[model samples]
Target chain A: MTKNDLEQLIETHGNEIYQFCYHLTGCREDADDLYQETLFKAYEIRKKIDKSDVDSPLLKERNYVLGIAIRLQKNLYRKKSRRKEELLDNEQFEYQTELASDFNTEEKVEKDQILAYLRKIIHSLPLKQRKVIYLFYFADMSVKDIGKLLRIPEGTVKSRLNAAKNALRIKMEEKGYE
Target chain B: MNNEEMIREALKLNIDAPEEINEKVLRNAKHKNQGVVFFKVATLAASFCIMTIVGTGLIVKASTGKRLIEYLRGLIDNRSYVYENGTDTIMTVYDNNGEKWEHVEYLDDEVTMSHPLSENETEYNLYLKVTGENGMEHFMNVTAKVNEGQSSEDLYWAIRGDFYRFFSPYTAADEKSQILAGLKEAADNADKDFIRDALIDVSADLENNRRILYEDWPADIWGGEGRYIFFEDLSDLPVGKCIIIINTVYDDEDSFIFEINIDGNQLYVNDVSFNKYSEEYYQEQLEKNLPIYDLR
Candidate 1:
């Protein structure tokens, strides 16, 4: 691939790809590493990607990066677990927060609490379940695509997504959120 | 906002990619490109074939055997059934450390009553007292009410509000198809408001929030209740099974030890120790003592 192609891919999908990495690892530090590795891998195999393979440029970009990420994550997880199983169990992850001044006080407070609860719920899910949730909700991927990337069936993807949502519902109910 | 919107909004936390990451990836890519040398076509083709063979072997290895997630998935029973005549449900749970304790829930007679109420419109407040050996007690109150003749689907919706209640003799995916079919009927109608009103009249406790929201509602949204929140037999758990206890609160001062085992088709939590108590002594005492209540 040309320098122009590389720059274009990064400029188009960098934030989204990074967000996927962040949700997968559930820690900013790990997400940074995974994101960097994913970009480098994409660059290495850029020549294999056919620009005209699909109609949507955005979809192609996402597919390329996510495909690399899924494999990288699986390999990294096995290696990490062999050394130490409890990767994120002991460490505390600080979620980045930004206060938007446009909203009124009451609206802002309500929104913030909901966001906090949801974030906590997401963070608490098992790593595999969290990945499915992030791809379905945040990445807006179809079930088929998620299945293909994860090398699982569509039923399994739906099953994991369902489990993640149920876990969230339980947490939310405990906190008095209907 | 609806669930989809709520989810999208909740996932909106701002993430700032580190400046170093961009610098590192581009630098490595440039170096790799510069170091590349022209290779003969025949040599390149040979290398590709060899790499493919090795890659295929690795992929096959990765696909073999049980994955960690699969084992974890089977940990929870898709559906648990308590005898209709039984008034109590008991199970054992385990902590991350493999300690076990018996957990018992005594459902009041009214709660376990299988007979329908005489009145066309009647309600019952199903009361349960769940107590652990660690002196932790939880009171559960589930409202089970019916208007007119009740369908099985309506009964499920009433209990789904509580996760623990939802798991009682849970329905498997295959069994849940009938419920989805029922919901699908409701979805077929073009008048969302009409169906919503009808649903409210039938079972106000129904958990069909998503069904009423979208015309082409996916079945998984409704399938979630049965698909998740299951009870697996303790005997089915692998030997030396351990689980992690996620602390809901930020503070770790009140952490409790939990462990589980299975016997006679009933699950039990054999050990529970509070931080304030002597864990070793407590565990020793538990091994000698019989369950507080042996309904079986």
Candidate 2:
């Protein structure tokens, strides 16, 4: 692609790719990194373009960008088998913003305390469940999409999400947040 | 619970990942390309008989010509396009960290797609083509609303308005689709005007990091029971205020009064977060998405 074409690509599909990365990685910083990696992959492979082969550049780009993102994420996790990294739980994520209200707000204080505990629980989940929880709750990605990224069956992604949700809900209920 | 709803809600969790994932991807892609010298030579040796042709073949012979409605339904539902490797000198930007970004600009050109509104004949088919990202073009067929006895002109404008509604989201004018989705929620609550004309913008106090606009709304627009004020593209709007244009077209105005439910979020947000198909997965999804006919 020439200067003009590359400019057009960025002008057209930049943010869309970023969002895809954001959901896949579960953090703004990670999304940006994945997006950069995906784009660079596309760039190196750009010479193979057969426009007639694909009716829409955006569609082609979406597929390519996402394909790279999934593999990259898997590899990243495999390399980091040491640290016991804690994930952000749905309850804490939901209430993290409402924690600083005035002293008179009894309901708000209770919500804040509950959320703080929820964060602690997420820190204790297994790695796979932790990843599943982030993708579903924070990224809002579809199970089908997650399945594709993980190279797992859609049924698996669906069940993983369901299990993750149930796990969170149960934890919340155990802590009396439901 | 349905897989769709479960998947949708499950996508809202807060997951943590190891840092430096991006750095590894760049190194990986680069390393993979290093071995491309052998991979390319091998693929080239087999390219001729393998794919039959360098491009995807999608020609179907129909005695009665193309079935507009069926063809359209397939395209829209699959969300699959002829996947191609971008053949140009792909100019890409990597923030010092190595993430890809394609900046989107509002190109005012209208993408016109028409299909036969009548199902009785194959000649009346839908043809749709729109301009967006270079390779992934969006194709959709318009359904007939003749049942509602809508005037072609009113239906046209409403659809045109809907096109605006659909495209407005990508242009970062979140109001058109966001309000419509919110109103659909209200319609679920049995609000009569939600469909006819109940779209509104409520982006008042939000500025940074606010994905959806946050604001208060009055009971009605200028006392019109079903009037609507929609935001076309307000990405550049001041944080405290949003811009909106009002539209008040009704079903009675068209002989073919039709109702369309635009999947505005998918159409605009490009939320392919969950879509798992790629050329790598294509050979696999193909077995599932379509069954190959062994004519041999």
Candidate 3:
């Protein structure tokens, strides 16, 4: 395939892939960075891609660029500890912060309390446990997929998830929150 | 502890993605297309050569074999095997790790895991999700309708990457992405219930997918050329009639719930359990077998 084809492919899938990166990473800046990184990697690997592979249905559509973007985001997610990535949108960020503060005072708090409680439960867990829980629960990914991305065994994935759930349940019951 | 409800609720919540990402995806694909043609050609040539050699051999073997049912079931349901079968014909589900999900919820049909299935319910929503062998996730929604004996819907979500045949008619990818993106955009600020309803489905179709296994091919299987679903129209069946089929292509696990409803004229059956009559429960069903459909 020629460089021209590469440009067209990028023009097609670039944004959607970027969106996926954003959702996975939960931050726009990182998503953008990952998007760049994915395209850059694809560029480097183009030598092996082949002229015929260009029109091959799968290649013409989604391929390693996705794999690369997805893997890169997870890699960054695992490595970043204590790095509070900034929310690029300031108004929504501040609004959320204000809501968190106001939530402590609350009206109709009992009705919506579960939402906040779940968030607390998520926040209270250890990072790895929380990561596994959110990835499974919120993202709805299977443990095998989580295991592969995390380079852990599937059993370990289940154990981590089970442990996360058990911890949450105990905390909820003890606090009379359940 | 049906936290499945809570989990479902959580998932139904939408996350907003930036608009420019689609352009970015196109940009990446275009860039990758450069310099990759040679490799693509070489691989195609190699694939052709290999197909010629094995194709004839496979056809002959297939002709002589016991139809891969036994061998494949053992392999696919192998309490342990893990690589993707991408036979796309297989519709088995798995746990977070790649093991088959043994979760079973028996229903009224004498269904096998290998046949194309068409189920009629007041409402059907099937969500197809894939987790990376690493933990990343992707999903599409398939919906079917069975009213006045007709089912009109079978659509699946497709991202730019999963959409094959960009230039060919097989390339339903672009249309899928447009739908996906539009849905994502259309979803802005809509309540959770609205989004969940948007994901509802009514048909389950896959052409001889491995996920569905039938003791016998029950004279009906759905087929089409897209990555989503096939819904044989249900407009002619008696309004109150029910036939349970399993087209596991869209679903890999046995943990699905089918809910049916017919107001007044029809007898209501919501998730009718068939354990008392299924062959697996034959020791018990032998006593009550004829009494079942005979009630009609």
Candidate of highest TM-score: 1
lDDT by residue (A17-133, candidate 2, tens digit) is 565565555456556666665565454344333477634755544554455555455434333321234243244335555436565377756645655555445434544555555
lDDT of 3 at A137: 70
- Model 2 agreement with the true structure over B1-296: per-residue lDDT tens digits: 34334334434334332325434444544543332211111111100101111222122321212222233221112111111111111111122111121111112212211111111111111122222343234332222121122233333333333333233333433323332343333234322232223222211202121232111111121222222212222233233211122222342221110011112232221111111123443343343332222111
lDDT of 2 at B187: 30
Weakest lDDT window of 10 consecutive positions for candidate 3 chain A? A86-95
A best-first ranking of the candidates according to their TM-score comes to 1, 3, 2
Q: Kindly list the per-residue Cα lDDT of model 1 for residues B1-296, writing each as its tens digit.
A: 87667777888756666767776666666654443311111111100000000111011111111221222211111111222122344332223212121122333421211111112222322322333234333233333333334333433333332222222221344323323333333334314343234334323222321111001111122211121111112333443323312221222432222222222321222222111123652454355333322111
CAPRI class of candidate 1: incorrect
lDDT of 3 by residue, B45-152 (tens): 100000001111001110112222222331112111111111122234323222122111111111112111111112222222222223322222222222122222
Per-residue accuracy of model 1 over A18-122 as CA lDDT, tens digit each: 877776776777788778877765664443344576547656667658767765664454334213233442222332245445555766767667776777677
Instruction: Report how far residue B44 has shifted in candidate 2, in Å.
Output: 26
True contacts kept of each: 0.29, 0.07, 0.07
Q: How close is candidate 3 to the true structure, as a TM-score?
A: 0.31
Per-residue lDDT of B251 in model 1: 27
TM-score (chain A only) of candidate 3: 0.47
Cα distance off (Å), candidate 2, residue B189: 70
